[model samples]
Target: MKILFLGQLIGKQSIAFVKEHLASLKAEHQIDCTIAVADAVTGGYGLGKNHAFYLRKLGIDLLLGGEAMLSKRDLVEELAQIHFVLRPANFTGIGNFGYGMRHLHTPKNQQLNIINVMGMMGFHRVHASNPYQLVNKILDNPKHPSPFTLVAFSAIASAEKQTMAHMMAGKCSAIIGYGAKAITLDAQIIDETAYITDVGRISAPFSVAGFTPESEIERYTTQRPRKSEELISDEIELQAVVITLDDETGKATHLQPLRATYPLNVKAPANTSAESTTP
Candidate 1:
């Protein structure tokens, strides 16, 4: 079985750009299931329930979001009952938002469990518990009848992701990863035991990680440039990762990194401007 995961979608163009490719890839690749990051779907802020529903209808199996998705009031209310989406499971608070994980009831006759967790060190406002602890609780639950298929996250760093994958080892099939910023196709295979991969963004193919470069250049142009909230890219490509699972073992054995670029032009500032708008 093949699972397709998309990076963060920042705006309407990004959404449309993703959908256009998703339809083609679904048929061409025989994609069994698909998931997309949700925080920036509605004008780069929190996702609206309506937007979530639209994405579901467009063939994405799950809509995954980060801390920003919880910022809206009405959206949070709807997300609590929305079965096709998930938020970080590690959050701790009185009125926290949606589920941190979900099980896929595939009509194609396959059962897959997917989880979402957040790292403790990020800019999020909620008090987040240790994700490793939460994973232990869920995996150890007697009432839970399914195997832990995969875990996804939207966070500040990759260090935690690699650590979690190494810790989980043979307990889960694969760990899905993508940071809030940084657009690179990176996957780490731990002792041939598990897979951890990050899918960055689907924004302007020429812009920096899909955001306008004015802010990024101004902030980091002086002393030393560092990759922060801006994904590590000046060109846009709708990036995603495809993992093929072992039919019986359900362990992910093959990892495929995918990217598609458009003809869009992103202008650079006068100081850093490039003469070419070509892809």
Candidate 2:
């Protein structure tokens, strides 16, 4: 009953969601290993200070990019069991004490392995970094254990992952796509690998963005020449636009326009003609 969890980081919320879901997945599927591939945590949908601290508190091991993970090795080691794998992950450093974790998800000889790769468009800046290369490198290297399952949290569109699906179709036992990209990628993987997509690794409430709302009401008082009067109010809509880049592509792929309406509540500047009078 061993399993792997795969995914891409969209933001702090993404990590929050994964950490929340991991416990349930472990209990339900009996997962034994997890390998998450990501760009810089701070740069993309990374773990912020608070979120990072919280994740450590939850006992989830995290692998940060070379710069972030290697520089703060001392602090990272003391805080939690998380490891920050330097760029270009090879099997040699797979069990490094400072940058990697070993003997985790124990009961050695487990069959499951999870690999989460960040796919947000343009969210990463590493040179010559490609999923195909990374996966191929891992396969070519003799350092990693074999006869284990591999799952990828690929965020590429369904069409893009197809090529990889073909290559790894039979090599790996199974592949599962996660996050919003799964909607289409899952179907493609089925067609290629003859294996249906696994929905277990993904978190619910899977929309890519998060937001909050605020409302304001302005009240006014006015008199119309001592005549009987009535009050009126009008609502106006205000829109806010937030542009965000896709995590993997690092391009402005998402444009979120938030629309909100607020009532100005004007009283005719206190000088409106009397519509009704009984003086």
Highest lDDT scorer: 1
- Backbone clashes for every candidate come to 3, 15
lDDT of 1 by residue, 1-279 (tens): 778877787655565665566788777777888888877756455577667777788789998876665755566876668888788887777364678888886556787788888787765466677888888777777244654277786667778777787788777777777765454556655543346446777777666655567655765676454332333233347777777777677766777777777533333211111111101
**Candidate 1 weakest ten by summed lDDT:** 270-279
Clashing pairs for predicted structure model 1, backbone only = 182-231, 182-232, 205-236
Compose the digit string of candidate 2's lDDT tens values, residues 62-83: 4333222322333334433443
TM-score of each: 0.82, 0.46
**Alpha-carbon runs more than 4 Å astray in model 1:** 94-96, 191-194, 215-236, 263-279
